[model samples]
Target chain A: MTDLQITVNGDPRRVPGPASLLDLLAHLGLDARSVVVELNREIVRRPRLGDISLAEGDTVELVHFVGGG
Target chain B: MLVDGPFASLRVTRDQPSFTMTRLGPLIFASMSTTLEPTELVDTPLTIGGRHFRSRLMAGTGKYRTNQEMVQAIEASGAEIVTVAVRRVDLDRTKEEGVLHHLSPERHFLLANTAGCYTADEAIRYARLAREAGFNEFVKLEVIGDRETLLPDTAGLLSAARALVKDGFSVLAYTNDDLVTALRLQEAGCAAVMPLASPIGSGLGLLNPYGIRAIKRRLEVPVIVDAGVGTASDACLTMEQGVDGILMNTALAEARDPVTMAWAMRHAVDAGRAAYLAGRMPRREIAVPSSPDRGMLA
Candidate 1:
């Protein structure tokens, strides 16, 4: 299988092929329930995470709520 | 005097010790006396976004030395609502020991804000992300235009507010002291309009009380002074002007003793609300003596 290339939080990364968004989150050690995933500048709802698949050269932005004033 | 009737007899008498009225049978007699007493004003809870809050003071979690300090100050201030900024979660930081730990969800109603966003698109994106993180649709929309002034970009603010409201988010827009802009925000379905007392973190206090008063006069929604409060008196003055609540950060965080300052702010807000409800005396150019002058004897 060909290695998949993607950008996560502005950093380029290579991962195994045929991976789901949930797999990517688990690989990154992020709790699926705690973070929001933005795939290619579009928000992927939590329920749809399993339905979405990672492709070659996809841009992903992971965001969460932090302490703010 | 004593009066006799078919049903009963009534008697009225005044003595040095006391005044008394006596009634017989069905007729009841009551004694009357007069004494001057000060009138008290009633206290009313402030409502925002379908929620009622006893304290009209909202504190910010930024600028504190530590999360513990922030908690102490917020608790001391008696603010039920605390504003928080949303950003990309720092994976390096401990997930359980962040700001959320200090601010218990049961005790504080977290108000997420778009602080660093400079445009409507960015603000909207942050708002959505915040909602995705399980926070309710409550957001403090701040579209900052200039770095020097730290003033809000009204255009971006209006645009973001409209988008958020349409998306079912309860938007609280931080705007300038412009009455027209405040009204426009209200028309855009904002839950509340937060006008800056001055620039953000400047601590200038309410530089233009009349401008704030004007905004409060026209808007049906709650008006909260969002920024630029320097001290406890600043919060009091803003409340005295009839604003619903105040959202402040630097004023308490940067104080010599944030805890003490927080306590003072709580009192200040309450005092101001009381004073405003009690109705202040009218201003006069000529001096009037509080004591009687005509009865003076030489």
Candidate 2:
């Protein structure tokens, strides 16, 4: 099986084809409970992280709270 | 680590006499908690989005020199509703922990802000991203118009507030001290309207007291003064205007001693609130004699 290139937080990463969003987070060593995942501009609720699979050329954003006023 | 910082000092022995101020801070705070004025008794908890918060002072989690300093200062400030900003996790870095690593969701109600967004759509997008963090739906919405001044674009702010409110997010707008704009935000269904004390980060301190007071007077929602406070006096004076709360960032984070400054702010907020509740005397052109004119000591 060929690897698929996906955009994660604007950086390109290659994962095995049709990897679940949960798999992407686990591959990146991210705690699913801590970060919010945005797939193709739609927010994926926590429980749905593993249900949806990433497609080629998809953009996924992982964001969390930072310091601000 | 139980031997350093104000939090660690919470374990100080009860017998430690002549305890240093910072070393034994919580004891002083606990002792000072007595009610000299029943301001809190009369004032209900600050309610926004159907949630009640005990502390009227909301603090930002940015600009501190170190994360340790940020944690210590925020903890020292006694802020129950703390504001944070949402940003993409830096994937290139070895490890970039989010602010949640320090702040507990159970302790501090996390209020995320759209701090850098300049347009309504951008602010709306940021707010949506923030809501997905699996926290409460409170957002401190800012639509900055000018890069140099960092003043808000009220037009964009109102539109974003309306959009976010429609989507079920509790909007707390960061705007200038303008009554008309604040009223519009309230009409837009914002849970709270945050008027500025001065320009953002100017530390100018309540440039227009009349304007800020007017906003608080007219708006049904909680009015929180969001920026431009430089010191404890600024916090106190801003609170004296009878606003529901005050949110500050640089005033504490940029202080020479953030921990001590946070302590001062907590006191200043309470003092000012109490003074406001007690009510100040009307200004007089001439002084009146405390002793009667007939009762001269001579």
For B136-225, candidate 1 gives per-residue lDDT tens digits of 778999999999998999999999999999999999999999999999999999999999999999989999999999999999999999
Candidate 2 per-residue lDDT, tens place, B1-298, comes to 1335322212323333333433322123223445542111123467888987767889999999999999899888889889999898887773888999988889889999999999999898889989888788889999999999999999999999999999999999999988999999999999999999988888999899999999988999999999999999999999999898899999999999999999999889977875676568899999998877896678
Backbone clashes, each candidate: 2, 0
Model 1 misplaced regions, further than 4 Å: A1-3, B1-42, B92-97
Candidates' TM-scores? 0.84, 0.88
For residues A24-66, could you state the per-residue lDDT of candidate 1 as single tens digits? 8887777787678999989899888988999999999887655
True contacts kept of each: 0.67, 0.91
TM-score of chain B of each: 0.85, 0.86
- Error in Å for residue A31 of model 1: 2.5
